[model samples]
Target: MASGCEKGEKVQVGKSDLEEKILETATELFAEHGYVKASVRDIAKLVKGSNSCLYVCFKNKDEILFRIITDVGSDLLNELNKVISKHDDPVECLQDMIFTQILFSIGAAKKMKIYLEEQYQLPPSLKEKALDQHRQLYDLYYNKICEIEKQGLLYQKIDKVVMTFGIFSNINWVYRWLNPIGRLSVEEVALQITDMLLRSVLKNSPLST
Candidate 1:
């Protein structure tokens, strides 16, 4: 019962299981300890296995880091999809999507931070896989902006691609200091972020009474 996990409820202890556990553990460990400090032994201790088990499952530490990078990118992609599934007004919908994405990313800051900070350590193929998923997620948002732009719903002069990225950059940086239990609510901060993004990108001028 490594990590004192109960049997059955405990993760399996074979090569396949060890691989999965190591990846999961490493995501957290890397967040807590960072890539240079977190080693195979640390991950093995949590999975009821040995360093040899990890080597069998992964060629090396970089490979394991790569896997974690892929997982986090997939998680963000899923969040983006979930946010857009609702069919609200394009303006409101995009705002909601940005807000939801920022809050969720903040909630998963440990994973997100590790994935961002350690991605460079992964081999080229691993970086490509993670980056490809990231690009697709951005493309989804970018294309949505383009569609709305065509409808005269979003600004035509402002580059949809650049605006989408600018919005993401503002929201993503919050994870550096945000707290789930902090004085500022995640939603409030996210809403403010949306206001800033919308002010910068909205095509239809705000209505004045």
Candidate 2:
């Protein structure tokens, strides 16, 4: 298997069953132990495979982490794109964006945990690539803020950049405290958070009044 790739080239590796198991196990271990502490052998042990067997699917631990982070980021962008395509109203788009993001945060909590906590551990080249995906995600929110502003629905006092990050701040930490068996279902939490965020930004939100 190809373990190394040129700078700026996408890291490609097999996605066979064992590959997924390795990735999944790695995600859990990285989230629990921190990236620096989670060894490739630890991941292989969890997957019930040897280190060489793990290498057949991924080049190394860094590649495994890269794949996990980038895959989650890509999956998020795709879902956000779908939300954008389905909503005509910028407010609606922004609402669904918040809702979708919160849901994703909770649903992919472990992977999101690794994304939040371990991304800086990636090598410079791979780190840049990962950050690029994040920038794209950020821009998606920024663009929607722009759309809302153009329509004069956005609060005049709100800074687009600040608001964008504020939305991220609101949703990004949801995984830490949200309980799956809690009284509120995931959708309920998402909607309530979405409403709170929208109220802060929209000039005419019902909650804003």
Candidate 3:
């Protein structure tokens, strides 16, 4: 909505609010038009702020994109940590993790889409930063699965790498076609997927020993 040339309307957006606005606009733009195609001026225009405001909040477009990716990653890790703290049983914790992943994927579908689909658009330096954070996320899930196996709670011996990838691949692909306005609410989709995944990995699963 922001044309590059119009003067930005002055508003009382605080530092945090302005940063959030820039990230939100960047996410939308990056989602609609790939990250390579979206411009800082476009984002500034949409937020009704000058490019200088964005610079105050972030160094550049890449930094904004990196922040979006890391922010979501941090939130996911925090939620996973909370679930782990609340649940002693590995199975319950894993179920909570699955549910949380789906719920977050639905809630931040646009951000997730940009993170997944436009990753290559970032410069090598920024791209590596994103990749490293992504690896950290994978490690979190992999370590959790390994913990369950170490506790002898696993239904069978499973490859932590394969299992982690399978779970993430199953859920992450939902971003490609998930409909937020479809018949099912986000909670319902999360629940359905959680049940499905738990059924596959639970100690008494039909598919397992």
Query: Whose lDDT is higher: candidate 2's or candidate 3's?
Result: 2
Candidate 2's displacement at residue 152, Å, is 0.8
Query: Which lDDT tens digits does candidate 3 get at residues 1-209?
Result: 33222234444656787788788888889889888889998998888777776777788888888888878877877877788789877777788888888888878888888777777777898889889978987887787787888887665756667788888987898877778889988788887777777665556643233
List candidate 3 segments past 4 Å from native: 1-12, 155-157, 206-209
Candidate 2 pairs with clashing backbones: none
Tell me the TM-score of each prediction against the true structure: 0.83, 0.90, 0.84
Give per-residue CA lDDT, model 1, range 33-115, as digits (tens). Answer: 88989887888777666667676678898888877777777877777787777765666667777887888788788888877
Ranking by lDDT: 2, 3, 1
lDDT of 1: 0.75
State the displacement of the C-alpha of residue 101, model 1, in Å, after optimal TM-score superposition: 0.9
Which structure among the candidates has the greatest TM-score?
Answer: 2
For candidate 2, give the lDDT: 0.87
For residues 68-179, what per-residue lDDT tens digits would candidate 2 score against the true structure?
Answer: 9999999999999999999999998888889998998999999999998889999999999999999999999999999999998889886789999999998998999999
lDDT of 1 at 50: 64
